[model samples]
Target chain A: MPGQRQSQPLLALRGVSKRFSAVQALVDIELEIRAGEVVALVGDNAAGKSTLVKVISGVGPPDKGVIEWQGAPVQIRRPQDARLLGIATVYQDLAMCENLDVVANLFLGREIHRFGVLDEVEMERRTRELLHTLSIRIPDVRMPLAGLSGGQRQVVAIIRSFLGSPRLLLLDEPTASLGIQQTNQLLDLIEELRDQGLGVLLISHNMSDIKAVADRVAVLRLGRNNGLFDVNTTSQEQIISSITGAADHAVAHRPHPEEVWP
Target chain B: MTNPLPTKARVAEYAGGVRRRVREGGLGPAPVLLALAVTWVVFQSLNDKFLSPRNLSVLSVDIVGTGMVAVGIVFVLLIGEIDLSVGSLAGLAGAVFAALHVNVGMTEWLAVVVAVVCGTAIGALHGFLFAKFGVPAFVVTLAGLLTWSGLMIYLLGPDSSISFSEDGLVASLTSRYYSAPGFTYGLAALCTAAYLLVSLRDRARRAGAGMPCRARSGIWVRTGLLAAVAFTTVAVLGHFEGLPLALLIFLGFIVASDLLLRRTPYGRQVLALGGGVEAARRAGVDVTRVRVSVFMIAGTLAAVGGLFVASRFTSASQVSGSGMLLINAVAAAVIGGTSLFGGRGSTWSALLGVLIIQSIASGMALLGVETAVQFMITGGVLITAVIFDSLARRTAASRVRT
Candidate 1:
């Protein structure tokens, strides 16, 4: 039953290019996300990964190139447009209401309804089902997201993407603030989504995450699509080289442990 | 293997889990008290009469006029903005209503209506200047505060004063009260049912959705306790005198505002913009519209507040709105727990903060504190409220981080 899910390409971008006022963030980009596959977009800081994600998520329209969904070319002009096209981006800021509780947060802006008042029942039920489906252990659904831990918060953010039944969940560094256990929990969720016929455009800087969860890695180096290869076939070194050119090495000069982690 | 639970069990577990998260919002008194403790203790010690109900009632009624203006200002503050001209807008509204009745020969009700509409239109004009052009609310409202007050003087036409009777329909709404026997009991029932229904519906949804839950017994107990406290206070006060009509107006304001901010998507958009402008716009919130509407709401509230003042005082005078701006409104909000930093605060804060400040003023007056001393004390309270707001935010942030 493994790999039983048949694949249809969910998204395809060919020769997409975007130039900002002072920099060309993406160039000669060709990418594809198939149904039931999780594609990890890996890059060093400022490696055009964010630019590419924005273009895909419809935050910004590409200056050039064609984007096709289900083999048909289309344009995405806004976040609303991207949502309409079944693309949901979980930004670092999380685009959530912290003042409201988890149920309220889940349904914010696009809240569920019951006779016009917030359909607390429907929103809570759906939020629970989604969280449970992802194997996210949230102690309370009524708890405001402010009370949840970093990992739990990530789960809320992740489940939110699938709320409207988006075909593609584009997560940006979903586990960046999470601890080891929470990271494992999210990795399992990411895999489960892929198993359930959902395509994920995951962006992460964590090598182990990319290695463990990414079925395929699309490497970008200096605003160009350097290579796309199966995670099993390509080495991390090669991916790093492709993501950050030799002049600007990819190895992070992390702050001294004494100064940073603590 | 994961245990598949019966429906009731599933509900129980989900409900049980979210108790911690609900506790985090500081919806309970601990945070509110913590937010107000230093001021409360200092003020209580500064004068023992601070806790006396008779003095408190007097203070409550006295603060109503000024507090009403502040309540509206809180809405503007929530979106990370300020309205300086509320005092003047209030003055203008009083003048317009009085002038319409006395000069234009309009009926009392018609005059009141005309004044409110004109005040709102002027407010809308102010909103256009702030929301449409990205002009700072502080600047626009500050300009408004001066322009509108000056306009009020212009409308007065050097008469210096206008007197009115209190038994008018407008007067009854703002000045009369039920004061009926057991009326407080009736009011208590209303508050309990409303609170219970809202909280229960919210809890039930989270349970069904398989989200988090608060402790069942705790939720009931807390809600019951709050209702009881509110009911008891009103009951005791009712024994003395039924609720003030001004209090009723304040209640209407609190409810309308809470509904506007919490229930509507438009309200959510306002909070989002207040939290951070760029992020909200990126998330597709109509930033311009949210900012503009918030100012108008503030303006409308100020006019409403001025009406209350005119009703209680029985006249609009040369000094009708003197020294009742910026500070009291800001104090009520901060004392109630709204944040100056924007994004994190509520309408409830305005009500609560107003009560706190009013009690101090009332108690001090009862203690025979000089007006000069009361001013100094209130100024201190404002500074203290801001400090608590900042600290609460810090504690909240650190807590969230964990």
Candidate 2:
């Protein structure tokens, strides 16, 4: 199945490093996402998962890195540059205008216009069609985003990212605030997207979500890559241990709490 | 989404939609309209002359100066920012025009252009400081308010007042009127026709796109209501000196501004920035450019408004854009239902808001009320409008939580 994808990765980051003032957010980060694959990024609270996503999404450029899109190195200095390079990102906050209606938010920076006048009809039609295809239910396209649930807003944000026909998707904690059912729905949608030959880089804390959908899991610890493992072959314990740096800790020899108590 | 519904069901849905919107605090212009109607009634009961044709005509003209400035304020406020400098900017622009045209002997048109350009440039400066330098909008404009007013006072010099020719372009703005019955009536008819045509075309396009469209009967009812308002206003003005050119020009600006904000991508960017600056930035919107341009619009309109004020009195003076003018313009925008928090407003809010303010002022003056009383009353009204805005925002926030 992996061989079916192109030989070159859809996106590859080599030796990416970023620092803010005295704090290093990321260091020597190496990662790859190929078409038709879901790469789950997992880490402890302060790990560089979000920083890496930001670098890829062009919210922040890496201080030292070679980011290759397809097979060619590219510079993504701004969000527009990333967008033009067919990379879409859904930030943890959703990055949506709550005051705007669903249709308006869906077509914010990329509005369909004729002679500078917005074509509301066309945009509305397209929004409805896209939502229908995704089987996402929105009460009304004209309903302001303030009236939407967290899950609905997240879905809308995802739909907005799709508007650019992006080749690679970067989702930063997409299900952080969603309910169980909504999370399930989102996970299913992610799987569907992956099947359509799009590469997905998912940042998540939920181990069950990674187990359920991720093709591979990448663990980060203290601003550095700790380990990467195939979801099918690796145990959740191993990934969690890597995330917490438990295997390398001096306390690794300590007996488990369950074993000691029992 | 486009399934057809019976008329009864459709009407019920429409009513429910309106109810939900109101509950969610999407009040739009309904509250302001009600307040306007109530104001008219209260004033009319106090002085029958308040509703008289002559007074209404004067009121129409009176709204133009402050109305234009208020319209500019709407742009700044839509981005969740305030410009305290607008009053001073207006005064400075008028002083510039007066100085160049009257004292320097510059061509009238050239002077007007230079004055307006000066305003635009000043606004760009304000925008630059706020957007690029990370200064708070309130602070930047507060500093501007003092600086520009000082400049105006300095420009006026010891004389402090300059009267221009009555028949000049500036003075003619207020002095001239389309008193001819045919012209006023024709304009009203033309506006109605244009509105009707636009609505029908929108409906047709929506239907063709397989989207739900407004019912034909609904469109007709709306068009009829608009025509009624337009014709009645024209008839009232026609009875007493017809429509003032200042009023006409003000309305034109309002319509153009409304279209620009509602139909253009640039307008959407402004609204997006107002909604959430961080979100707008992430969405690839040029936040700096939009902010700068919005300030420029506010500045340009302020100058235009100042010119109208000068035209009304046929002179520019130290007090031209001073006193209650700044408060009145800001109050008008808020009163007209433009959200102070930004991202939700129309240009018409300025017109409607200024009308309410000017009506109260006009009514009190007619009743021989003291200036202090007028100020207190206007202050009270401004407070109430702000309370409404706060409550509406709270309701909307609560709805989001649910």
Candidate 3:
């Protein structure tokens, strides 16, 4: 069963289209991610990066689409459904309870219990172990999330997704506020997860981050897929053209940057 | 990860933490404790009869009935919500109990049970509207405040009041006292022993896990201090009528609620949900269930408290749970160290908060002050408590940052 499960792509989307009233947020999107691969989804601002993420993460359902999980069609109508299908989402906002301690936040929804009581000792131990394995430097697990730096808070949020050991991870702007050193650390963790056979969908704007660990790059422009490239073979300029909808065959072509940014 | 501190360094670290706490005005209940002490000293000096055992005993019992309502408020406030309906809820509970038992000729115990259930249901309704419908808790409960008060008035008929039998079960709950003073001292001793036991067990667990914990000597010192405080309280209250049942009930409620908050998963979830609803929802917590359940608990406890007050007076009237009851309960929770913004407070705050408010009220009354002056003084103290809470939170945030 494990071997058979490993043979299929972890997640696949076919002809997915989502419309918000008059706006076509996502149109006829087709994407796939296999185990042991990092797929970077990049696009310009307002290119529907967030909308696509929400659809996949079950924050909102696509109006028209077929979502396949491990070679079987599945419907993700809510966040809980996505979780049950072994898909974990680390949202852009991080969705953290700042007042709770690190251990509490990490085990917020699924608390360990002994004799019908919160097993703080066990939770704290597990928290310490996970942080140590990730080599995340948090001063104290007992410290509230409010006190942690931006990078540390992001690390905790990502680790929360890791707790479920999902087959697929959806990270939306996980490194947005992080510094260079923190971003590097996060890239290393993503690489590690990929090596452990976790399929990661990294939604990022930073080209450097996409190049650092992504195995493949999928570019979105104006609610449509512009291009897909092998990171090993594609040049940075090629991906940029795809993202900017300047590629000759790209959908929803825009005027050159001089006409837009100027 | 960093290695665990050695014995000597761990002890020094513990000492440094304590010193920092003192410098930071001892976060949590320390400020309130100090304020209470100061208030007691001033009142003692101002009135010769203030410190007398008889007067002290009365003051202790008087705080308990209100203490019950304040305990529920602590739960609400801890989650960063307010229940304006608690006063009306309590009044309605008392009125319901009286109407059911007196007017309807039902069994007293059965009526009390039904009254408490009514409180729970009403509270759940308020919680449902707020949590499920996304109505503002303040608005929902504010409407409840008016609605329940009106219901209480209507329940009591034309007179809007009903008296209980003097020797009834509920009446004896507050008015009675232990036969001997030794029981009071023994209870204090038992509590001290329990504290010592829990601390020792926790220390051992930390040691076994190779986690840093308080020094052995520090734990002993804390235990000794707790014992001293317990014995002193017993000595003071034991002089008059041993221990009042009301105060004992209040203390028990505080301890049980403290256990629920600290030791249970539900309590942690309440704090978590209060801290961030979205985060909790993502984590698989039934946010609506937790919110609604907390409101129900608040309502039921507030009603229970009202019953205590009614029992003390042996009557339920339109004015029984009205007037300053709501403000005093909330003020007590805040003064005791519960944060108005939520996600940081303890059940013990209710006990401390009620004591502080009642002390001032009792003291002012002893001084022959007018009700207006009492209101102003209470208001001033509540404002002071909020200021202190804000300062302490800032200090804690800064400390955590470093």
**Top of the candidates by lDDT:** 2
lDDT of 2 by residue, B1-402 (tens): 545545555455545655665666566898899999999999999999999999999999989989999999999999999999999999999999999999999999999999999999999999999999999999999999999999999888899888899999999999898878888889999999999999999977766666666778888999999999999999998889888999999999999999999999998999998899989988889999999999999999999999999998889987777946788999999989888999888999998899999999999999999989999988898899999888878777887752
- Lowest summed lDDT across 10 adjacent residues in model 3 chain A is found at A253-262
DockQ of each: 0.28, 0.61, 0.48
Task: Score candidate 1 by TM-score against the native.
Answer: 0.82
Ranking by lDDT: 2, 3, 1
TM-score of chain A of each: 0.84, 0.91, 0.91
Error in Å for residue B40 of model 2: 1.4
Displacement of residue A175 (Cα, Å) in model 2 is 2.1
Is 1 or 2 the stronger prediction by lDDT? 2
- CAPRI class assigned to model 3: acceptable
Question: How many steric overlaps does candidate 1 have?
Answer: 19
RMSD of 3: 2.9
> What value does the TM-score of chain B take for model 1?
0.87
Give lDDT tens digits, candidate 1, residues B1-402: 234455567656655554544446544434556645665576678876565565545555666777778777778888877778887888788888888887777899888887777667777888899878878777887788778877888887877667776677656655565667566578778888888887787766655444445546757897889787777667655654567777766777788888877777777777777655765665666666777677778778788778777777776664656655556777778767788988777787777777767766665666788879888877776787678777766766677754
Among these predictions, the greatest TM-score belongs to 2
User: Could you arrange the candidates by DockQ from highest to lowest?
Assistant: 2, 3, 1
For model 2, what is the error of residue A28's alpha carbon versus the real structure, in angstroms, after optimal superposition?
1.7
